[model samples]
Target chain A: MSQSVNDLRVTRSQRFIREALIDLIEERGFDALSVGEITARAMVSRATFYRHYRDKYDLVEQIYAEAMQALFGAIAVQETVHSPQIWVTFFDHVAEYDRLYGALLGEKGSPWFVRKMRTSLINLIKEFGRAAPQWQSDSAHPISLYPAEDDLIPDVIATMFVEAITWWLEHGKPFPPQEMARRGVALVGAIFKETSTW
Target chain B: MSQSVNDLRVTRSQRFIREALIDLIEERGFDALSVGEITARAMVSRATFYRHYRDKYDLVEQIYAEAMQALFGAIAVQETVHSPQIWVTFFDHVAEYDRLYGALLGEKGSPWFVRKMRTSLINLIKEFGRAAPQWQSDSAHPISLYPAEDDLIPDVIATMFVEAITWWLEHGKPFPPQEMARRGVALVGAIFKETSTW
Candidate 1:
């Protein structure tokens, strides 16, 4: 019970620091931000901040890493691999953290975050491919029909997903979460038409 | 005859300045470069540099503008609307200016150039949509089969093309120009399958 209490306290402090950092970055700019002000705003001491993160940059990545861990954890529990449910779960996750997503991918936001997100998405895509090998290795979806080389297929899918999310965000998200998920699943279906069975 | 000679002299001087700027940017970076060294390297007097461009920023845009104009010029001559020929012409242009493309889009390169390239591509895509209304308006390809809204379609296509080129360049351009063009067209075809008739 004491260990659990300690863990909860650590989590609360970490969240406060990350949120404070983002607020400071948006208020001025990342270049002008300082660790001192971040701790002050978060109501945490400088010592606590240092114990949790190496520096401001490390904290930014940690925020993204935590989000990815939660997202993939939710995805892992889903029963179906290729269903629209997978995308719906993703869209819901994005909606839940809409502000953070916007700031992280916004025009003034750091490209470092966007690149990190892309790398994570690529890994998730590769994992999806493994879990559901039906996409190609299955007898139904012949590889010759869609001639993208083995190395490039995952990247192409990843780009499609990234571009889709980017458009949804930039356009003020005209479609609801379900609709966006629908369009995404449809597009993926189109790309892997021969393997739609998956 | 004197007027023609004056025009030729101006063009030569402008080209020299632009070349010098590109060389220096590759050696160091655009942020660290100075107008004084640029003039010295180009062997153009300060008077000539100021007469041609208000500053170095203007000159960089001029270089990109000229490249875009030339690319569009070459693309304009092609007869077919949806042929792979368009991408081949593009890949040829990138190959022709391999070093400049590398500097403009590589890791150390500025995102300004990448964004500029994207805007130009979006324009080209819009123009292509206009010139080849045959894809949909011609009545051969129905709208229902491909459900992307009209406004979003051009942006989607533009992103795909940009990401593909960006990938090719960052990967040391593993595939030959012709092969890259082939893959691009094939991917575009897959995206706009029902409308492939265009």
Candidate 2:
């Protein structure tokens, strides 16, 4: 087979394995399921499984990364400073992964999912800080004085947003996703506003 | 032996087992450790170990519960609110279990530990909601409403606070513990303030 065809085959196999693992996990908890079971379910050879993933944990991480990338990608960046549209985009983005997010953040969810989400959010904030010149302006007072230096601000805010969303999910998400997202955006905005003043 | 004396003996043995397990986790990492190893290290019989804990996971959960109880007990509750004092108390409480918290929330921490923390936090929040009266007010708007239903605000806030703290620990606590606690108080306070107005 040509190199491109081999690559496509490999990708297809990886996707098959990942989907199988998720199905297995949903049926049996992550701890209860063994990797041999995963391979058997995927109808793949042990060698193929090992070649694609170091272990079940690695495969889980890969699935989480794909979910995060897809979630982040859905949120289009604002070319201009329009807070409401940005908020709407943010809500829509979160809604895209609501099912995965619910499973990952639910009572029976894996801690690896939360950890992956936290890391992704931190990276996203750092990327935003680097790309947005407004984050560097002195007009913001305390925040301006310590933009990159106070990386904790973004980390804390991101954490709060994620936790609030998780809380909503585990408790049945009483409000519409858009409404929850709106509240989340407002909460973070209030936090940043306070910190900048401080 | 007297009933109290027998109780004391059982408690001491349990403590010894838990301490041994923690030491093993610190040295070998939680994933690498086993129930047999914990029993051997604690100098207790496998029967005794089983009597005290169903499994390694159960033992870890007990340790987590003890740490949380100690931390929560350390916080002083008053009839009237004093935000800064409350924050100071909360930080001091968390500092008491810094080692366990650090091990659980640190980069090299165990997945089991992290999951235990999240579950405990959720339970704690539910308990708080059950105990807090202000959460039941009907005037609160949907935008300002606490995530939990009537009398569940405390539980919701507690979960949110713990999740934020856990995230901070995993991502590298950028701010001092006191500052983080203060921020937590402020976040909860804002939610309450908004609800009252609504």
Candidate 3:
């Protein structure tokens, strides 16, 4: 067989395995699942599974790493003005993997995944701070001016965004990503408005 | 022994058992924990453990139930005006159980616990809406006036609060409950102010 044909076959098998893992996790959660079940669901042999990945943990880590990279890439390329459209781009990235996000962030989801995702989000917020100094200067008092006691502001804001995103995904995305992004910008502005009063 | 002595003994044992469970959960994630380790940590026998509760699940459920009941009680008795003092009172109640809150809301925490707590918080926010129509009315527009597409405002606010509380507890609470409460109220106000702009 030609090299291209082999690559196509490899891609197809991996897609099947990935989808099967996501569906199983959504149904029975990650811990109760097994490689045997994953292979069976994917209709691929255990030999094929072993050939591609080390184990479930390896597979999931790879998947999450890729998804997070895509998410950050989506955010990084946006305009530095910190507009609602940037939020739209972020949510749109999440929308592309809503099923994986829902399975990983649901009640049956892993705490490890949540922590990893939250750290990425916190970094994204910090990146926003770097990309747009005016974002802070726009406030009456810059975030840095707040006493050290209130240094958790970035964390607070990040957690808020994480929880809101979890809420949005868990609730089936009731509003379009664009609408959620619009509301997100407004909410951040409001949070800053309140913070400045201190 | 007198009846009063027996009651005191029972109270002490239960407290020890509860504290042991929290500490153990913090050390090791909940699912990996066992009744034997819990009793061993509490320095109590398995016989004593069974006398008070059915199993680990029963013990955790009872602990959470009591904690949540106390939390609602704290929120319920607050002044209906939704002042920063009310948030202080709420954080005070959480501070009283900061250990358990930390364990349950931490990276090793249970997702079930997070969901249960978030629901309770959402209910608390809804209660506030009913208790203080003036709270909503104080804004240029009432919460109910938002289009259905944006009806997730309450949920967004509740999640923000939960995430903030989790951050506070996880980070050793750099500020007093009063300070965190003050920040919380301001954040909520900002969210509402932005929502009203819609």
Candidate 4:
């Protein structure tokens, strides 16, 4: 237990560094920034930064991995597989970090930023698939013919959701995060109509 | 007429370069590549490569942009608002380019690729929103109560779809493209419950 607490502390410190780097990258393009700049802006020693990452690129991966883990965890907790409330939970999750996500992912219009977001999202989707294996096989009444061996359904939904968020952020974050989540759930539901066993 | 032909030539050359790059990146890794190496592998002159793009990154952006354009165009044609066929079309479009996409995006596992994919997907979702304004205002049903103004429905769906494709690619392209599309459409349909409209 003590060792676990120490591990948690190390993880927290690493997250702090990554979040600070994301903040800096949002302020200035990733290409225009440097390792020293990130360390300085993050207020961590260069030694510490290197100890955690080989370079800015590697740090970007770590940041992405961390963010994805949190996002997936939230999604998993809210995983209803076919419930409207699942969306409600998702909206709540997005609302909590709209500002940070809006800036880092919605803005910055950089190739690197976009790339990181996609990889993280993909990772999250795979987790979702694993979590909801029955989703592909439980075709009951109205939702019959669930493709038991394909991954297409998840791909389309995931792509659509990310695109909507990007649109919201790029268009100046016109709506509240909850609203965004609600609408997202609705749209997803619309695209993938629900069915009951009866 | 001459100018159009010239434009075609330019487009073809660009496609060739991108295709070659995708192949090379798959065999090795992006980090192990350089402009000279890429140009050499593509069998194009360095001068021609520079004329088309400033560097390898520029070429990457070009590929991303073109791929996105293709994807959006395919979606626009479907205009399903609430149909399984729409999902089918989307799956077909993505599966067609499985090799190139799987290598650069699904398998490469690069942050840069992820960012590019996200940005492209988001742009496509925005296009979908613009094209399907009805989706923004339809509240006759309980699912529509979220109000498009504050919703992130499009983003969530887009993100899911893209991620699913990435998952498919990484997991060995298990299902036939059309079967994959059918499953995707059905899954999303159940989730959204928009069957009455269709």
Candidate 5:
């Protein structure tokens, strides 16, 4: 009972800090942000802040790490790998924290964050490719149709996925998660056909 | 005769300065670089550098502007609008200055450059769409298949195109210009088919 109470306190404090950071970043960008401002905004003491995060960068990093882990975890538990539901889950996760993501991926955000997202997306894609050989063997996707010697397909798809999300978020997400997922799947399918014909 | 000589000298000085900027950016990134270092490396005096550019940012901006202008100019001259030759000219132009582009779009480069590239590509795409309605009317491409009310297709395609180039350059460009062109076209064509069937 005591441990559960402690965990709840920790979660609440972290959420406050994270929300504060997102609001501040959206207003003034990450570079100009400071710990004092974040703590003040979150109504938390400096000691409390330090207890949770090493610094602002560490705070942002932890937030991204936790969010991405949660996202991937959700996708992992899906009944089928690389299903349309995967994209739906991915976009839904993004939409859940739309404001935070928009700020992180906007012009105000750091390039380091963008690069981190790209790397994570690429690894996720490669993992999908491994788990489902049929995704490639069945010619269901364009990435699978690449020549054996060419290894840039993953990079290409990852880039596209990241940029699409960035563009969507930057534009205020004109489409809902389901719509985005549909368009995304259609894009990959289109690429597959183009590759096979070529 | 004197005017032509002055023009030649001006062009030579700008080239030296631009090359110096690329080399310095590749080595230490844009932030760590200084105007003094650029001028010293170019073997030009401060006065000569200022005569050609206001500052480092201006210099970088002008370099991209000229390169993009040259690329669009080449594409504009193509006998057929949206022809395969356009991609060939683009990839070829990129290959001609592979080192410069790689440096600009690489990890060390600024986000400002990436944003600029995205906007330029989006505009270029819109221009093509305007010049040739058949590109869409005949259902020849995926972008054309997008519902008239949906405007995100240009953004999606632009993001994909920009990110793909960035990835290719970062990966040391595994394929030649012609090959890259073919693959790029195939990717676009694939998206078309996906959109049509969806």
Candidate 6:
């Protein structure tokens, strides 16, 4: 096969493994899953599975990280300012991978996944801080002044948002994506407005 | 022996196992630590350990539940209103079990423990809602107007709070307990405020 064809085959293999991993996890769970099952579902050999991914956790992380990039990339286009719509859009994107998120971040999900997501989110928030006027400027900054004990502005904000998503997933997504987006934005706002001392 | 002396023996046995579990978790981490080690450290037989706890996880959950009670109980006495101090006081209480929490909720923690903590916390938040006027009053209830979609008000709040503590523990308790309390209350407020349209 030509180089391009080989590259295409590699991409297809990766997608197959990732999708199989997702389906298996959603069906059974992340913890009880095995490589043989993933390979069987993907219609690939164990060697192919090993070549495409390091392990089940790595597969989960790969899917999660990609989904997050797309979700945030779409939102970042219109997110010059933080809006309630960001929650709406971000969650709507998540709902696209509903079962995947549920399996990886739910009651039986791993902390490794949460840790990866939080770190990714914190970076996004920091980028937002630099670009946004309110976060960037001394005068407009909302909660950046109390540097003695609260310099981790992005960490707190990212954690609050990520936890909100985790809670939404665990509770069966009680509200639709749009409503979740609305509640989510409000929830983030409440964290900011209710207690100023921190 | 008298009834009092029998009760004393039971108490002593329980303390030995609980303390041993904590010490072992702190010294190493929860996942690798075993029943054999816990028994050895506490100077109890495996049968005795089994008598008081179903497994290592049961022992961990028992400790967590007890800690939460003491933490919340202390706060409730001064908590006619839910103040930011509750966050401060709660984290301060958590500090007492620093290593155990690290083992159970940190990077090396288990999803089983997290699921248990989340469920317990959701209950606490529900209880808080029933008692708090803002959450109780039909007209005043923040998210309760849409009963079908919003029954999980306390669940989300409790999750956000729990996750924040998890992050704090993972990050080596950077802000100290009091400041953690303050930031925690603020983070919760922000969640409530920003996405109010929902």
Top candidate, metric lDDT: 3
Tell me each candidate's TM-score: 0.69, 0.71, 0.81, 0.58, 0.78, 0.71
Ranking of candidates on lDDT, top first? 3, 5, 1, 6, 2, 4
The complex in candidate 5 yields a DockQ of 0.45
Q: lDDT by residue for model 1 over B34-54, one digit each (tens)? A: 898899889999888998788
lDDT of 3 by residue, B1-198 (tens): 235656876888888999899888899977678899998999988888999899887897899899878877877786654555767888998899998888887777775677667777876666554554554555555655435534466666676677778878888887899888877766675566566556
lDDT of 6 at A36: 93
Report the C-alpha lDDT of model 2 over A166-189, residue by residue, as the tens digit: 766666666676676566555554
Rank candidates by DockQ, best first: 3, 5, 4, 6, 2, 1
- In angstroms, how far off is B178's CA in candidate 2? 6.8
lDDT string, candidate 2, B1-120, tens digits: 235656875887788897787677667777777888988998888888887788887887787777667666664453423334555665666666666666655655676675556555
Candidate 6 stretches with Cα past 4 Å from truth are A1-16, A40-44, A72-89, A129-147, A150-153, A167-179, B1-28, B32-55, B65-92, B135-143, B167-197
lDDT over C-alpha atoms for residue B50 of model 3: 91
Q: Which is superior by lDDT, 1 or 6?
A: 1
Query: Can you give the lDDT of residue B40 in candidate 5?
Result: 95
**Candidate 6 C-alpha lDDT tens digits along B1-198:** 245656877788888988887677667767778898999999989998887789998887778878888876887777454545555666887788777677787656775786677777776555554544443233433555335445455565665666677767776787778777766655544444333334
Clashing pairs in 5: A190-B190, A191-B190, B142-B192
How far in Å is the alpha carbon of A113 misplaced in model 1? 2.1
Task: Write down the TM-score for model 6.
Answer: 0.71
> lDDT (CA) for every model shown?
0.69, 0.62, 0.75, 0.61, 0.74, 0.67
* CAPRI class assigned to model 1: acceptable
Q: What is the lDDT of residue A162 in candidate 6?
A: 68
Greater lDDT among 2 and 4 belongs to 2
Q: Write the per-residue lDDT of candidate 3 for residues A155-178, one digit (tens) a residue.
A: 666767777788788888888998
RMSD of each: 6.5, 5.3, 4.4, 7.3, 5.0, 5.2
Q: Write out the backbone clash pairs for model 2.
A: B125-B155, B129-B151, B129-B152, B129-B155
